[model samples]
Each structure stands twice: as structure tokens, then as C-alpha cells.
Target: MSLLDRFEQAFMPNYGVPPVALARGEGTRVWDVDGKEYLDFIAGIAVSSLGHAHPALVEAVSRQVATLAHTSNLFVHEPEVLLAEKLLGLLGAPARVFLANSGTEANEAAYKLALTYGRREGRSYFVAAENGFHGRTIGALSLTGKKSIRDQFGPFPVDVRFVPYGDAEALRRAVTGDCIAVFLEPTQGEAGVVPPPEGYLRAAREICDATGALLVADEIQSAIGRTGHWFAHQADGFVPDLLTLAKGLGGGLPIGACVGFGAAGTLFGKGDHGSTFGGNPVSCAAALAVLDNLDLDHVNAVAPRLRSGLESAAHPLLKGVRGRGLWLAAVLTEPRAAEVQRAAAGAGFLVNAVQPDAVRIAPPLVVTADEIDALVTAFPKILEEAAQ
Candidate 1:
């Protein structure tokens, strides 16, 4: 039996079967089990910030695992402390960090903090944007506004009101004083890399301030130099009460963090929340390596090149490109994103059909200019094949 067959026999059907069975990867390239090489444009859904098998991440994980790996949060590890300090330093704010094992867990921690604060303040509702995605867990799913995924899991515990994305007026109207928090993604990754309109984040902040509601920015896919900034909201000159991070934080290792600023930091008391592998030394060390080696300058410089290249492609299927920095989407004129993805993979490239009309292209931050130009040159032909 092939790897796909073996996967089908052993694994659950939730994720379905991935088209390719990858065996190894280095930098921005990967080789499948059959020795087929492809340019990995998706970068493991934006998780591999430093790229596959990076020496820094390898050394850090190896050293930490050899010295100390699992601590169960019962003991304080140097790597964990240093990672938290690094994140706080990046934020340049007074905040407390709760480490977790994934983006879902981080959002769950933020949810609990919001609930605790809401209970104390007598608020009972949350406002989230339509088509926004946090994660698949219960609390995070409750905050998710996508009907196709959320409707099946409903009768959620939290009371949340959904509003149109990029519409400041809709958000302002939905976020009343009775709302506990306003959950938002700086860029809606799962909803096709949809960035909100300018001043929308500032307006949300103002609305939350006026209503005494918490502003929660879920930056799971947009942070950690993905958008050429430490945090996406920082580009708009606003700070959220709570910020959830994951994906690229550990450079591919499983780690997440929920940071609360000001009084929101003190919402969770003793015994309120905890995790067994929340701050594993190995993951923390890997995250530290990612932070130490991240190149924001490279991200800023190469982003425009990629964006302009995609936009310059004279293809009838490609409508335009959206997003900032390494996080981008090629908007299609028709619902042929899956076809485009398959065509890309066949042509020795890998991208994601984030939505029926959008193909997400988030390559590794270390991808070279030549590799980018190669993709840009091939994109027109890829779309032509997909059209067939």
C-alpha cells in the first residue's frame, strides 16, 4: 500500500487525505516520497518561518532536548522565561504571557481571560467579524464567524454577535457596552487573507474603549514577521488588550502564547488555567531561535517583489493579489483555486486554495529572490493549466 493508503487506514478523516506525501524539506523546497521536488510556497500554512530543517532551530531544539525537554509547567525553565521576555520585549509593553501548545489553546486562554473579566464587569456578549477564523477548539470555534464550519458545532457556550469584516460602522454598531470583548484577526487568513480597511482597527479600538470591552487580536497567521512587523496591529498604531500568537512562533515546533496587557493580564487567578506542555523547554528554545534569526528587513524588502510580480502577471483567471509581506493571496476571477493549487503542485510548486477564489501564497521568510521570480514566471502558465 502507498503512504496515502496507509494514512487513510490509520488516521481520521477530519483533514481528509493530503495530496502529496512529503518525505523531507530544506529551505523553501520539499521532496515527496517519490522524490518529486516542489517549491513550498505555503510553508506549512505559514508555520515554518525559518524554513525546514534550519540549522538554528535544529541546534536549539537539540541542545534544549539534550539538557531538558518536558517540565510540565511545574518547574520554571530558563528557555521558557527567556521566550516570554523576548515576546514582551517585541511588544514593548507591560503584559503577561500564558504559553500553550497551539494557536487554539492560546485563543482558549484569551477566551477564559475575557470571560473572567466579563464576569467581573457584568458583561455577557462578544463581537466578532464575519468569515474570521481563530481555531477549531470549542472556545476559539465559538469566536469563529464562518458559518460553514461553526454552524455544525453550534449551541456554543458564549454569546457572540457577528459583523461584516472591514466595515467599521458594522463593528461599531455590533460592539455595544454589553459586549465582553471584540475578537478580530488583523488579516483573516482562513477567509482568504482578507485584510480590513485602513483605520478599521483603530475604530474597533475606539469602540471597545467607549464600551469598556476587551479588544482581542488573533494574530496566529499574521504575526512573527509574517507581515513585516512584530505585530500587524502595530502598523495601525493601536494595541489590543489581548494578543494570541502561534504558527510561526516556534519555527515549526508546537507552541502558542496569549498575552494580556494592563489589567487584562491579571484576569486569570491561581488555578484558573494551566497546561502540561505549555512551556516545554525544547519548544521554547526553538521559539527563541526563530525570534533571534527572524529577518524583518528581508521580509519587508521581498514582500513588494512578490506582490508586484503576482500583480504583473497577465492572466485572465488572476484578478489581483491581496495582503502584506509574505502573507499574500492571489485572487482568482472564478472559483478555480483548487484547480490552480493542483496545477501548481504538478508544475513543481505548492500553494493553498484558502478559498474557492483565493490561492494563499505564504512562502518561507528566507526564500530567495530567484525562487520568487521563478514562481512569478510560472504563475501565468499555472493559471492557464487550471483554466483547462
Candidate 2:
């Protein structure tokens, strides 16, 4: 039996069956089990920040695993402490970090932080943007606003209010004094790379300041140069009270962080939270390598090329493109994104059908100019095939 057949027999059907069975990757390219090479535009759903098998990440992981691989929270590790310091330094703020193994766990830690803060202040509600996706876990699911995925899992443990994204007035109304926190994504990646309107984040900060509600920015899919900034909220010039990060932080290794600022940082008293493999030495070392090698300048330089190329496509099916930096979505005039995805895959490229009418294109930050040009040149033809 083939790899797909083996996968079907061994794995659950939660993710459905993926079309491609990749074997290996280098830079911006990947080869399937059959050795057909393709440009990997989706970058493992924006998790592979430095591309596959990057020397820095490989060397770091290899070295750390050789030296010291696993150390539970009972013991202190250098890589873990260094990783926390590095993340805090990047934020340019004073905060406490809770390391985890995935974005979902990071959000779950943030959820608990909010609940603790709420209990202290006698608040029982939380607010998040509509269509925003946090994760699949119970606590994170409660914070998620996508009804299709979340409604099936309810009723959740927390009371969360859903507000329209980019609507400052609606958010202002939803986040009353009883609200413990307001969760927002710098860009809603799962919502087809949707970015909030200008001043929306500023409005949220002000609202939280007045209402005494914590502002939590979920940067799982938008941080680590994905939006040409270390953190997407940096573009708006405001720091959140609680910030959750994962995806691309470890250069494809499993790692996540929940950072609490100010009083929120000290909310967790003794024995509040802990994880067994939260800060494994190898993953922390890999994350440290990713942080050291990340090129924000390159990200800013190449983002415009990707965006302008997609927007310049002359195909009738192509409506336009939206998003900042490498995290972008090609908007279509019709709801055929799934068809476009399949056609692009057949034509030796990989893209994601994030929604019915939007295809997500998030390449690695290290992707070269030539690779981008190739995608741009092929996109028109890809659209033509999908249209048929």
C-alpha cells in the first residue's frame, strides 16, 4: 500500500485526506513520495518559516538533542530561558512567558490567564472577533468565533461574546465592564487572511484600557516576520496585555508561548499551570535558532513583490489580493478556490483554499525573488485552468 493508504489505515479522519504526500523539502521546494517537485507556497500552513531542513534549524536541533533533549518543567534549561528572553526582547516589553507545544496550548494558557484575571475582578465574559480561529481544544474552542467548527463542540467552558472583525464600534459595545478580556488576531489567517481596518487595534487598546479588560493578541499565524514585522500588532504601535505565539516560531518544530504583560504576567500563582514537554531543550534551541536567523528586512523587501504580482494578474477569475507581507490571500471573483488549489497543485505549486473564494499564499520568508516571479507568472495560467 502507498503512504496515503497507510495514513488512512493508521490515522483518524479529522483533517480529511490530504492530496499530496510530501517526502522531503528544501528552501521553497518540496518533492512528493513519487519525486515530483513543487514550489511550496503554503509553507506547511505558514509554520515552516525558514523553509524545510534549514541548516540553522537542523544544526540547532541536532546539537541540542545531542547535548540535552528533554527536560520537564521540574528542571531548568538554558535553551528554555534563552528562548523566553529572546521572545520578550523581540516584544520590547516586560512579560512572563509560559511555554507550550502548539498554538492551541498557548491559547489555552491565555484563556486560563484571562479567567484568573476575571475572577479577581468579578468579570465572567470574554469577547473575540467573528470568524477568528483560535484552535480546536475545549478552552480555545470557546474563544474561537467560527460557528461552524465551534458550535458542534459546545457548550464551552467560558462565556465568550463574538464581535464582527474590523468593526471598532461593535467591539466597543461588546466589551463592557463585565468582559474579562477581548481576544483579537493581528490578521485572521484561517479567515482567508483578513486584516482589520486601520485604527481598529488602537480602538481595542483604548477600549480595554477604559473597561479594564485585558487585550489578548493571538499572533499564532501572523508573527515571526509573516507580516513583515516581528509581531503584526507592532505595525499598530500598541502592546497587548496577553500575547500568544506559535507557528513559525520554531522553524517547523512544535513550540508555543503565552506571554502576559504587567499585572497579567503575575496572575498565575504557585502551581497554577505546567506542562511536561512544554520547553523541551531541542524545540527551544530550534526556536532560538529561528529567532536568531529570521530576516525581517528580507520579509519587508519581498512582501510587495508577492502582493503586487497577484494583484497584477489579468485573469477574470482573479479579483484582487489582500493582507500584509508574505501572509496573503488571492481573492477570486467566484467561489472556486478549491478548484484553483487543485489546479495549482497539478501545475507544480502548492496553495491553500482558505475559503470558498480565497486562496492563501504564505511562502517561506527566505523564498527568493525568482521563486516569487515564477509563481506570479504561473498564477494567470493556473486561474485559466481552474475557470474551465
Candidate 3:
């Protein structure tokens, strides 16, 4: 049988079958098994931060794997400790870090931390924004606000209150003294890269402080310099009590972290939690390379050029662009995002139709000006064909 057939037979149907089976990738481009090359805008769903096969990432993983790969939570390793220290430095706060394997696991750790911290103060109710995507795990899913996914996985551990996203008054109303924590994404990724109004994060911080609830920032998609900033929350100039990270944390390998700042840092004692493969040396090494190579100055310079390129479009199918930095969404005038995705693929470009009317683009930090120009120049034609 063929490779696609083999994939279909062996893997679960959760993601369905991907249209293309990529063979190899370098820089911002990937080649399929049949030798068809395409610009990769998805960046492995925002995980491949430094792009595919970056030399720094490659060397770090290779060196670490050849040296030491795994160590259970019982023993401490240099890479893990160093990565934790680097992350704390980047966060610029007094915090404690718990490493995990993925975004779900990070959020799960954060949830438990919040629970334990809340129980200490006699609060258990939780709050999250509507349409937010956390993860598939039970505790993370319980915090996710998407009904379609939540309904299928019934009987969650606890019911979490949901309010309209980007509405500060609603958030304030929902998060009272009884509420233990509030989970929020600075910019909603799955819901089409929607950025909240300015000062919204500050408001959440203030409200959580007043109510004595923990402000948990879920930066799974927004952190790691995905935006121009090291941490998107830093742009708002406020520190969160708890922060969860994954996606680009390891550049490509799997790694996640739940960091608690100040008082939240003291919540977990011995025997609180552990993960066998969470802090693998190779993954931590890869994460350090990613951090080392990520150039925030380049990101700050190129992001606006990308945003302007999309916003300047005058096509009938194009509506406008939304989001910050390298993370952006092309809003369509009609519900033809799927058709647009297909057309873009046919034109040797890969984009994601995250919503019926939105296409998301999260290219690697190393994407050059010419690549951005190519996509911008091709977008009008791509949309016209989709409309046809």
C-alpha cells in the first residue's frame, strides 16, 4: 500500500487524512513525496518556530541525543534546569516551572496548580472565555470553551463558566471571589487569530487581583516570540500568576511548561506532580537552541511588512487582516476559506482555513521578505480562482 494508505490504516481518524504527505523541509519550504515544493505557512501549527531543519535546532538535538536523552522526574538534568532558568529569565518574574510534553499537558499542570491554590483559599469555580481552545486532555478540555468538542467529551471533572471573549465587563462579572482562576489567550488562535482590545489583559489582571483569583495566561500559540514580543503578555505590561507554554517551545520536538509567578510559585510542594518524558534532555536542548536563535529584532521588523502586505489587498474575496506579528489571519468576504486553501495549495502555497471565513498564517521566524512578497502577490489570484 501507499504511504497515505498506510497512514490511514494505522492512525486514528481524529485529524482525518492530510491532503499532502511532506517528505522534507528546509527554511520556509517543504517538498512532498512527489517532489512538489510549497511555501509552508502553517509552520506545523505554530510549533516549528525556527523553520524546518534549522542548523541550530539540528545540532542541539543531535548533540543532546548522542549525550543524554531521557531522565525521569526523580533525577535532575542540566538541559531541563537550564531551559527552566532561561524561560524564567524571559518571563522576567519570580516563578517556578513545571515541564510537560505538550500544550495540553502544560495547561493540565496549570489547572491542577490553580486547583490546589484555590482549594487553599476555599474557591473551586473556574472561568474561561467562549470559543477558546485549550487542549484535548480532560482537564484542559474542561477549560476549553468550544461546545462542539466539549459536548462530545461529556461528564467533565467540573463545569467551567464561559463568557464572550474580549468582553472585560463579562469577564469581571464571571470572576468573583468564588472563582479560583480565569484562563485566557491574549490572542485567540483557533477562533481565527482574534486579538483582544487594548488593555483587556490588564483588566483581567486587575479583576483577578481584586477577586483573589489566579490569572492564568494560556500562551500556547502566542508565546515564544511568535508575535514580535518574547511573551505576548509582555506587550500588555502585566505579569500573570500562572502561564502555560508549548507549541514552539521545543521548536519542533515536544515540550511544554507551566510557570507560576510570585505567590503562585510557592503552591506546589513535593509529590505534587511529575512527568516521565516531560523534561527530556534532547527536547530541552532543542528548546534552548530555539531560544538562542530567535531574533526578536527581525520579528519586529518583518511582522508589520507582512501585515501591511495583506491589508493593502483590494480583492473582492479579501475582507481584511487581523492579528499581531507573524501570527495573522486573512479574513475572507465569504465563507470560501476551504476553497481558498485548495487554490493556494494548487498555487504551491500552504495555508490553513482555521474558520469558515478565515485563513491563518504562521510562517517560521526565518521567513524572508521575498517569501512574504510571493504570498502577497499570489493571494489576489488565489482568491479570484477560489471565487470562480
Candidate 4:
């Protein structure tokens, strides 16, 4: 039997059988076992901020594994401390960090902190926006407003109130003195890269402050230069009380962090919450390498060029483009996004059907202009096929 066949036979059905087994990657490109190259715009669902096999990530992972890999939560390691420091520095406020393994885990940690903080302080309910996706876990999912990802996983941990996103009036009306936190993604990634109206984040922050509730920002998909800003909320000049980060935090390695600022920072005390592999040295070191290799240059110069290249490509099926920096969504007239996604893959440019009529294009920060141009050149053909 073939390797894929053997794997399919052994494993339970979950993600379904993938079409191709990717062998390895370099920069913004990956190859199947058969050595067919694909331009990777998906970037592992926005986790590969610096692209695959980046020298910085490679070196850091190697050095850390060669030295020290894992230690107990009772102990502190340099890489973990450094990674925490780096995250805090990017944050405008002095913050405390709790690390986890994925975006959902990070949001779970945040929810726990918020609930604990609110319960101790006499608040009970949490307010989240419609179509807001925090994660899959019960606590996080409870806060998630999208029914499709939640209805099956019923009886969640906490009671949550949902409001329409990007509407200040909805937020103001929903949030009351009994609310614990108002949670939202600055730019809703799973909602077809929907960016909230300007000043909405600040409005939410204000409402949270007035109601004595924490404002939680889920920057997991948009942070670390995904949306042309370190934290997507930063672009709006709103500071959140609790921030959940993952996806691109470790630059492809699994790592997540919940950063609580000001008084919210100390919500989780000793013995409150912990993780075994939360601050694993290798992952933290890899994250640091990713950070070192990406910064302002990625935001100002490279992202715009890539955006232009993508925007430069036009087709009858494509209606418009939206998003900031490298995080972009190509709006199409038809809802056959999955078909276009297959077409993009067939054309050697990997894209995501993030919504019914939208394809998300979030390439690595290291994606060159020429490579982007190549993808653009191939995209029209896919769009044409999508038209069919």
C-alpha cells in the first residue's frame, strides 16, 4: 500500500484525506512528495508569518533543541521569558503573559481569566459580537457568535450575549454593568477578513471601561504584521484589556499567549491556570527568531507591494479586494469559492475560501514582489475557471 493509503486505513476520519502530501518548504513555497511546487498564500492558516524553513526560524529551533527543549511550569526558561518580553513590548501596556499551544487555547486561557475576574468582581455575563470566532473549546466557543461552529457543542461553560459586530450602538446596548468582557477580533479573519469600521475598537474599549469590563481583542489571525500592524487593534489606537494571540505567534511552531494588561494582567494568580507545553523553549525560541526576522520593514515596504500585485490582477469574477498589508480578501461575484480555491491550487497558488464569495490571501511576510506577481498572473486563469 502507498503511504497515503496506509495512513488513511489506520487513522479515523477527521480532516478527510488530503489531496497531496507536502514534503518540505522554503520561503513562500512548498512542494508535494512528487516535487510539484505551490505558492503558499495560506501560510498554514496565517501561522507561517515568516514563511517555511526560514533561516532564522531554522537556526533558533536548532539551537534551542540542541540546548534545552522543555522545562516544568514551576521553572522559568530564557527563551520563554524573552518571548514573553517581546510580546509585551509589542503591546502598548505593561502586561502579564500566559502561554498556550494554539489560538483556541490562548482564547480559552483568556476566557478563564475573564470569567474568574468577573465572578470574583461580581459580574457574570460576557458580551461577544456576531460572527466572532475565538476558538473551538467550550469556553471559547461559548463566546463565539457563529452558530455553525457552536450549535453542535452545546451547553458551554459561561453565559454569553451576542451583538452585531462593527456597530457601536449594538455594543453600547449589549454591554451592561453585569458584563465581564466584550470580546472581538479587530479584523474578523474567519468572516472573510472583515475589518470593523474605523473607531469601533476604540468604541468597544470605551464601553468596556465605563462598564468596568475587560475588552478582549482576538488578534490571533491579524497580529504580527498580518494586517499591516503588530496588533490589529493598534491601527485603531484602542488598547484592549485582555489580548489573545496565536496562529503566527511562533511563526509556524505551535505557541499561544494571553496577554492581560493593567489590572487585568494579574487576574490569573498562582495555581489558577497552567500548561505543560505552554512555554516550551524550542517554540519560544522559534517565535523569537520569527520576530527578529520580521518587523517594520515587513509592514511598510513588502506588504504593499504584494497587495498591489494581487490587486493588479483583475477578472470578471473578482469584484474587489479588501484588508490591510498582507492580510487580504479577494471578493468574488459568485459563492463558488471552494471551486476557485481548487483552481488556485491547480494553478500552483495556494489561497483559502474563507467565505462563500471571498478568498483570503495572506502570504508570508517574506513573499517577494516577483512571487506575488507570479500568483497574480496565475490568478486570473483561476478566476476565469471559477466563473464557469
Task: Using lDDT, rank the candidates from best to worst.
Answer: 1, 2, 3, 4
Tens digits of lDDT, candidate 3, 296-339: 99888888988999888789989999998999999999999999
Candidates in order have lDDT scores of: 0.95, 0.94, 0.93, 0.87
Off by over 4 Å in 4: none
State the RMSD for candidate 3. Answer: 0.9
Leading candidate by lDDT: 1
Give the TM-score (vs. native) of candidate 2.
0.99
Candidate 4 yields a Cα-based lDDT of 0.87
Per-candidate clashes, comma-separated: 0, 0, 0, 0
Give residue 359's lDDT in candidate 2 (0 to 100): 99
What TM-score, over all chains together, does every model reach? 0.99, 0.99, 0.99, 0.97
lDDT of 4 by residue, 2-111 (tens): 66887799899876776667889999999987889999998998989889998888989999999999996979999999989988887857888998999999999999
Per-residue lDDT value at 277 in model 4: 94
Model 3 global lDDT (CA atoms, 0 to 1)? 0.93
Candidate 2 per-residue lDDT, tens place, 66-155, comes to 999897999999999999999989889889999999999999999999999999999999999999999999999998989899998788
TM-score ranking from best candidate downward: 1, 2, 3, 4
Ten-residue region with minimum lDDT total, candidate 3: 150-159
For model 1 the local lDDT of residue 280 reads 89
